[model samples]
Every structure is written in C-alpha cells, then in structure tokens.
Target: MNDSKPTPSFWKTPFGIGATVIAVAASIYLYIEHRNHLLALLPYAFLAACPLMHLFMHRGHGHGAHGHGQRDDTPKRD
Candidate 1:
C-alpha cells in the first residue's frame, strides 16, 4: 500500500504564485476604487486589529507542538 502523500500542484499550493497574483490584483483594484476610504481606515483598522489578532493567534497556538503532549487530559497509564 502506498502511504506517501501527493505534493500540491502550482495552484493547489497555499499562497502560491496564482494566489499572490490574485491578492495583488484585488488590492490594486480596492485602492483605486476606494482610495479615500482605504486611506482613512487603513491605519485605524490595523491598530484596532493588532491586539485582537495577537490574542486570537496566541490562544489558538498556546499549546505546544503535538497538541500540548496528549489527546487525553487525564494522566496516562503505563
């Protein structure tokens, strides 16, 4: 039986060239269409989101790798 995983193709990969191109294009379009709105909210939005983003990220990753050691919280038997 084959246990190996198949590698992702160009578009299938996360944050690949295609994704980057799409994101850049969208950003450019938004900037052109809503330059004033973007300018007004960009800084405040970033500042407002910074603390919440940090809390969210830290909460999500607080446990160490390997899911904080064990699936069951109770002590394990030998």
Candidate 2:
C-alpha cells in the first residue's frame, strides 16, 4: 500500500500568492484614489447596519413567544 500526503489548497500555491498580492495592491490603490468617496459613505453604512444588527441579534431570543404579557414557562428561582 502506498501512502501520500494530500496536495496543498489553491490559496497555498505560488499562483494563488501572486493573485493575492495583485488583489491587495489593487485594493490599496483604489482606496487611496477614492478615500474621500469611501469615507463619505461611512455614515450610510452604519445606518444600514442597524437593521441587520436588530434582525440577527434577536434571532436566538425567541421574540414574541414569551413577551408582551405572555406567561413564561421557565421556573422562577428563589
């Protein structure tokens, strides 16, 4: 029986490294060229995040199931 190690993922290869370098360089160039435009949108981005935060933050709370005058089934501790 022959045993061999698995090949590395694409991101771990030389070509992937080159591509990543290029992508990061491009991103830096773009940000430098449009810093003002991007910064101007920061407030709008924060506003958009508010609704998303509310939606995700309440997901585990089981909202509307135990609140609003409804009696909770959990036992009260002394």
Score every model by TM-score: 0.49, 0.51
Residue 77's lDDT in candidate 1: 55
lDDT per residue as tens, model 2, 1-78: 779989999899999999999999998997999999989998999999999999999986768766688878887464
lDDT, candidate 1, 13-39, per-residue tens: 776977889999999999999999999
Candidate 1 Cα outliers beyond 4 Å, as residue runs: 1-15, 60-78
Model 2 alpha-carbon drift over 4 Å, by segment: 1-29, 74-78
Best model per lDDT? 2
Model 1, CA-based lDDT: 0.81
Looking at model 2, residue 78 earns an lDDT score of 44
